[model samples]
Target: MADTTGTVEASQPGRYSVPGPPPRPRSQLVGTGFAIAAGAMAVAGALGHYMARRHASGIDPGHDWLAGQSVPNPQLVYALITLLVSVVTAHWAVWASGRGERGHTWVGMALTLVMGLAFFNMVMFSLNRMEFEIGSGEWATLAFAVTGLSLAILIVGMFYLGLMTLRSLGGSVGRDRSTPLGAAVFFWDFAVLAWAATWYVVYVVK
Candidate 1:
């Protein structure tokens, strides 16, 4: 009864639980930006594909002024799917990064960033091929060569990042964090590969 409360509190100093690391303000801001961008891309991809399909079909859909590209329907659909998946996973990664689990988010975002650029280029190449009926001449050949090299590098980068992320999970660096960022990274990696395959079928085979 004499100072019993004080003795109990002293024995369990952390009974109230220690607070986690403070939120990284700058990192959270960047993460939010990435999430917003990803959401925008998702919406854009959906709308753009619908318009493109309508344009090709000559529906004259009013909301889709940018819809009427000459690209094949399947390719447009593939692109839409790819972009949507990329955006969704990217946003998830960003959210995880904002919560202090950065390794997976970083890997995922880096993969998407590089792969997104390549995807953009492939889209342009497809547009030229479909709209202008451009054949695989010297320029096209060189472009494909570079794209192939870049794809190789991209695959290697993804593997390296994935391995590093997995390693970090077992180490002290990532031990304090709890997020499924690694899953997000793997998701984006799959999306990239799927996009590459779709591009090959849509552009290269044509």
Candidate 2:
């Protein structure tokens, strides 16, 4: 009496639906959101630090203490680098998520958490020492702290994504894992280098 013909055909094996790849995972949204938030914070911190330094030195907007040197405006440069790293890490998270993987590797996550905390401590200690010596006001000190914290978050996210990419390279995790892994390695290592340079130049030398 009813439309039983359609129901009968739907019951047939491989008749109602065509075989296809599984739906892609959505866990990457978490990492991407984190990366973007960290980037926003990083930009704010960078501006704060730059302004504080400029104010301390009584330098006009167009001038810098290292005007004679080729690599002037260290704070702004560091901010730009952090922003770039954030973007790359976010992209990696999206790519990995699209592969239908459930989530990130635990080892990578642990490593990133540890390194990020350590890096944050180093940055804060160095900046605080400078603040103490220079007797900077509360606002300037706050700015430095903000910059350090933001960069720390960025580093953790980036490191996690980088290590994940590296892990994928060991096996056939993805078709082009190597490419992303290379980028991860570069950015992760660059962060370390940048930290060391910043410590020496900003805290020790300057």
Give the clashing pairs for model 1. Answer: 51-67, 52-67
Worst 10 residues of 1 by lDDT: 62-71
Candidate 1 lDDT over residue span 42-150, tens digit each = 4345434433444554355332322333334454445545556666656655565656666666665665555556555556555555543224342333334433443
> Candidate 2: global Cα-lDDT?
0.47
Candidate 2 residue 127 C-alpha distance from true site, Å: 5.4
Tens digit of lDDT per residue, candidate 2, span 31-69? 555545555566556655655674676454224433333
- Per-prediction backbone clash count: 2, 0
The true-versus-predicted C-alpha distance at residue 175 of model 2, in Å, is: 5.8
Clash-forming residue pairs, model 2 = none
Candidate 1, 139: how far from true, in Å? 26
Compared with the true structure, all predictions reach lDDT values of 0.48, 0.47
Least accurate stretch of 10 residues (summed lDDT) in model 2?
A: 62-71
